[model samples]
Target: MTELTGTSTGQPPTVDLGPYADALTHNPHPVYARLLEKSPIHRATQPDGTETWLILGHPEAKEALSNPSALSSDPANATPQWRARYLGDPNARELPQGKSMINADSPDHARLRKPVQRAFTPRRINALRGTVEEHADQLLQGLPSDAAFDVIDDFVAPLTLGMICTILAIPDLDRDRVRGWADRIGFPTSAEDVTAARHELIPYTDQLIADQRIHPGQGLLSELIEATDDGQMTPTELRATIFLLLNAGHETVISLLASTVFCLLSHPDQFAALRDSPTLADQAIDEALRFQPPAISAPPRFAREDCTIGSTTIPGDGSLVTVVLSSANRDPREFTHPHSFDITRPPGELLSFSHGVHFCLGWSLARLEAGIALPALLNRFPDLAPAAELSALKWRSGPIVRRLEHVPCKSGARSSAAPPHNN
Candidate 1:
């Protein structure tokens, strides 16, 4: 383990993360590099004045994520003061939203993750390739020939949203509303906006769950509903699990698609490589995930007991710790030329979707979507390039997820010539 020194009090030095939050949003690599260089772990203050332990090194992050006993996923295990300080309203009585597998531990996590895990298996995702490809082509076909299109609005958002909705069997009429709720929740907005999105989404999800229970269909949601019927989960757990899948499923893909295009377009050589050898699509997607992960950090984990992460000790009193996945993916100790965006780089582990028990449930689906969507888009528009300069792009402002506000690209007339290979 890498030793990380702290203050005289044994607590890591306090750094205000607020000042760098905007910079972190726009392009976090530099800020992350600085933090990692100083120390892989730091006690940082969030914009809202909440204190948290931020882990930046690849090894330390893996340690924190894989150790569930010391670092509990249950927010309910956190101290009342910690909850009140960070989450607000500690006394608020509500159903266990935190009981979802993403936020659960041990027996609860296993029970919640088991029922629907089969739906996201490699076999199931492979079966959905046709549907994913069909949707990708449909979205690509709609692009205008004469002008620049916002990839976020025109392509990634709709493609990912539509795919998840189809998989979950969400009604078409309700998708727009669901998208609105997802947008408000996923991006950085006012606290009121977040609360409002949750308010709208919870009741909507409840109704969806109720409907699934009554009239089971052919999707993962229906499968989970059956699990609920069989005493595998509670109504609240069902609702929360569905909500997690929907929110995580679409949003992460949105970021992946946008970031993949942005990265590829910026590196024309790699883009050409992928375009030339379409077989490299899988590697390209992995590189994209490593280079610019959608989720910059994992959800907060609470320390269940006095635990030592590296050489630094975290008190057991429900202290919060967040693993910076973005940083870990770029750690030089783990990857060769970590800053370079090389699609052909040897495959390796990535903290982007996290590791251990809480590893992303929808990873196969995410990979499948990117594998299909990227090559199709490039194949259709060989001359596709960024409509605006990188400096002009606006990134979403949030600590957890990193994404551009829009990726405007000018798809010039389709190239009749064969795809060019890197010279």
Candidate 2:
């Protein structure tokens, strides 16, 4: 284990985050809290030898993101040597294409995100109300009230995938394919698997875009492809759009849902309180989001131009700065009782979904899924409880998405609603 050499004061010892990797995967709050007290930005070395400036303070993280000039989202700044040093050897799939919306800054990101943004606009997403709710109900339909269930495997993952599938009107997508892509993308053990999945998905999305082009559907993919405007998305961009929608669509929501349920199931009072006060779901989700963010931190960002975070000025184009959201959510400067999960919180303090121009575009959809699925799940399994030992359950590992491998649970009270799959 990495030694905790300093107290909640002084220049904390430069800690190696690897030993705590297990705790980080399952529950990172303790480590996050510890890091926040001493310094918001700490130098950390990974087992892979990559170094990062981990920004845990809320203000610092926001600054790091908002100051695009100082920090670039471009992966191009990452030298081929560095890229190979990290994800290149994962040996799972090939490394993600070097430049996507996530990697590009300014004109590129704006160009890429613009047309697709129209489809995700509040009104457009609001129009999806019925489809979203129907899928929520459908997911609830097959869940067995008295059986043991893995929420990640059987529920959350399916709900997110189905929602994205609907958005793309992908009629023939096998759930297995979606799951495999997720596993490959999220857990990049080897570069081969990562590259293979990334490339494979392009063709998969290409085929969907082609079908949508011929027979446009009521879904967003077709809408984005055929969007009428001066700033239209090219076929390549359309493919990227679908890829982003599919990959980003469900993964975090699944994490948020499963994490929230775990929190509620463990804390019975909160569960009962939520049941009694339906309005609390909004805050409950926010608190859960802050407390157990699905993605602890985003990839290291580089400077496109000169920028500063506090007193430190970053040079133009290639300075690496990471916004460690996990730490930020617990930053004492912004949150009170940051260690505890309280549903009744003032919203602005949390940055789990991020903030500013790069704020997650899928925020509305992710929240809606959680807002619907959780209440429905609880209503069905009123007496649901963890079926497996907390210490025994596995937490999925990655620098990208963090979640449980399985949330095995014994279903409680029978739901009057149709089983999740039946719907």
- Largest TM-score belongs to which candidate? 1
lDDT of 2 at 197: 86
Q: Report the lDDT tens digits of candidate 2 across residue range 1-423.
A: 457445464533556887776666666777767876766776666545565667778888888888765576766665455556555542322235334466667887887777667777889888888877787787678778667878887888877888788777877446679768867887777767776888787777778777777898767776687653344655565666677677778888888998888767655667678888878988898888987788888756866576656655545635456788878888878888777767777775668888777888888888888888887787777677787655566777675678777888776542233211100
Q: Per-residue lDDT tens digits of candidate 1, residues 1-423?
A: 123334697565687767766666777788778888888888887657777898999999999998999998888777777666435568632323446888888998999999979898888899999998888899989997679899889988888999999988899898889888878878747766676677778888988887877888888898888888899999788888888877888888989988888887777778788878888888888998999999989987888899998988889988888899989999998998988889999988899989999988888888888888888888778789777775567878454677878988887633233322210
Estimate the TM-score of every prediction.
0.92, 0.88
Error of 1 at 92 (Å): 4.8
